[model samples]
Target: MSALRAPASPGTRPAAAPRRAPLTSLPGGAADRGRRLDAVRAPLQATSGVPFLVLCAVILAGALLAALLLNTSMARGSYEASRLQAEVGHVAQDVQSHQEKLRAAEASLAERATRLGMVPAEDPTMISIEKRAKVGVGEADAGADATLGP
Candidate 1:
């Protein structure tokens, strides 16, 4: 059987349009120069996703670095606080030791007074004077006189 070609209708269309040369291929003109300049600046004009991602990455990195620095500063402060607490504890221990030594010294002074023939009086005498009084104004007792050395 012979293959028959179909007749073209009045409104039939071609398979494809004719290819034309780009505008830049033509002679130099304002429009062509503009197109050339646009071509040159197109890459710069159209933003790429990489720059956005890079900006986000930079911001994230900066935030992380700031957090790290803040945490480091806080850790240093904690360390300093711990050191100060330890120092306070050591100072408190020293104060306690000094207080104990003072108590011992006071006891030793009391013992030394007793050894030096000083007796603690059971009844303490108080003589109040509004103005200066003459020496030996208080009444003398035999026990007081006996306590004094001859």
Candidate 2:
């Protein structure tokens, strides 16, 4: 019967043994065990997305706050600019009114001068001074006579 069994094919290979992991090579190795102990001793680890979501929320809140602040500042600036512009316009109008009042006052003064017998000078005289003339210090008096000719 043994001779009746066909000889094993030289090209065929035997089945390999089922491998078993050693105690140290188990699923929870030293590093995994330490991690497990740390988890038990310390607080639970946060979800992977919790911190990322918190950071996003913080960034979004910051952006909103910045936008609000910027908008408020811009609004204040715009209001101030408009107020100043209005003030400038009022000041300009006041200046124009003052100028008109001054012109009217000047005209009234001229009319009153003419009514009070103040006439424009027909012949205006100017005293001439020559280099050869010796003007004494006492000649500065209003009653002193100074001649223009040398």
Candidate 3:
């Protein structure tokens, strides 16, 4: 049987060993201790509230500025409206003054015509330019009009 022991198969290949990560520093530079090392990290620091406060302040200032501009615009518009109302009142006064003057002038004209002995014609006559003749005899006066009393 020792002589009959099977020879190693020539057709079979040997399996490769599993790959492993190389060890870095371990206390005294120990190798292959089979322990994973923890990674070092930066320490946590406290953040300041100044940047947030500044942002809030800027937004508040912008809102105030917008409100100021809106108020100014409203005030300007109010001033313009008041000015236009005053101008309208002035125009109305001017128109009324002109109307009063016209009335006075009309009355003056009537009185002047009476003083100049210009009387209203009872039987009005017209010379027709187109026909080149007198339109009527015009000798009769107010007798045919029923509205006139004898």
Candidate 4:
């Protein structure tokens, strides 16, 4: 209220306060100076810091976006690694199957040879080059020459 306002007096002004009387050419009346001060300090406004807050929000949003992208990329890499592992498993199974087939073929080798009328030799002999004749060999059976090449 106007009644409760501080009265215009030298007592109200601080002892250390400097005056702008020469520069501003203020009026000599104490009432005018008091009113001028009240007008200067009336309904004072300050910065709302909207720009700083907006910048901080933008930075935070950018960080969150980067994190989301990073997470998505890592998940994609994980899925790719899993897929490659599955492929390796399949390839391993294929290799195992091939090894099994080779083992089966090796196991049937002797049986196949018997079916083809091939037999293991009871005695192994060789021709002597110096003597120009067979050596350490018994006489052959009558049909032996038919199966053995000359």
Candidate 5:
């Protein structure tokens, strides 16, 4: 019903939308402080050419890149560690196999020596030396020959 109301007749011309209210300076009230804040924010808004959403996107992209780089480095280190561990395992297996072969060889040598009438000598001090004087050169004394049996 006031001057700002729209026309009721649809057949007539369409009424224009009301103009926005003018900017007004307010007192030191909270609403006035809010307007003052807006007034102070205007220059910052004008100077900040980049939009907030775009800046956030750029920051997110940088963080993602850094994360990706760190992930790649960690993956490479993990692979290297796995490879070294495998190598160590392989070397350990080789050492075990070699030790087994050495034991088998020592056993075989002892068996062959026993077959050929070779035996480990007893304590040299326990043998009597009197028989050594009677035995000719290149001939083993009777006491020494008795000690040589398997």
Candidate 6:
């Protein structure tokens, strides 16, 4: 005769109990218990116009800046173009006046030469006013080139 008791195993360990979370760690704790938290956030969730409004505001600001820059650049370009045009006009007038003066001087010289009876000789002579003499020549032949027909 023996007591009917089961043998205990020496290699097994006891099971661990389930741990509870700390009471103070609940979200918002006791302060969020009043009213409906979901209802407070309903307006934000239902509204779809906020993002569109923000996007429009950004685009409008960008357009305004672009317009301002374009206006400034156009004004500057116009000023430079007008200034250059005025300078060109002034230069053209100066050139015309110089051309008239040159024509008048040529006319005056021709008239003076005619009044002095300096006739156009059949054989015209050329005299060199340079300090150097002709190289490799016994006599300086001046009118040799002029004798050739134009």
In terms of TM-score, the best-performing candidate is 2
Stretch of 10 with least lDDT, candidate 5:
133-142
Q: Write the per-residue lDDT of candidate 4 for residues 1-150, one digit (tens) a residue.
A: 876966569757645776665655446855665654433454567868999999999999999999999999999999999999999999999999999999999999999999999997777666677666555564564324322333
Q: Give per-residue CA lDDT, model 3, range 79-116, as digits (tens).
A: 99999999999999999999999999998997899999
The residue pairs in collision within model 1 are none
Q: Point out where model 4 deviates above 4 Å.
A: 1-48, 113-150
For candidate 4, what's the RMSD? 14.4
* Reference-based TM-score of each model: 0.46, 0.47, 0.44, 0.45, 0.43, 0.44
Minimum summed lDDT over a 10-residue window in model 4 is located at: 141-150
Find the 10 residues in a row with the least total lDDT in model 2.
133-142
Q: lDDT per residue, candidate 2, 24-140, as tens digits?
A: 545766566665444346557755888899999999999999999999999999999999999999999999999999999987997888999998755443454645443553433
lDDT of each: 0.74, 0.76, 0.78, 0.78, 0.73, 0.73
How many backbone clashes can be found in candidate 6? 0
lDDT of 6 at 16: 81
lDDT of candidate 6 over 1-150, digit per residue (tens): 377855657987666889997656357744567644443344645767989999999999999999999999999999999999999999999999999999999879867999999876554445343533333332345434423222
- Give model 4's clash tally: 0
Structural RMSD, model 5:
13.4
Which residue runs of candidate 6 sit more than 4 Å off their true CA positions?
1-48, 111-150
Clash pairs (backbone) in predicted model 3: none
Ranking by TM-score: 2, 1, 4, 6, 3, 5
> Which pairs of residues collide in candidate 2?
none
Q: Report the alpha-carbon TM-score of model 2 versus the true structure.
A: 0.47
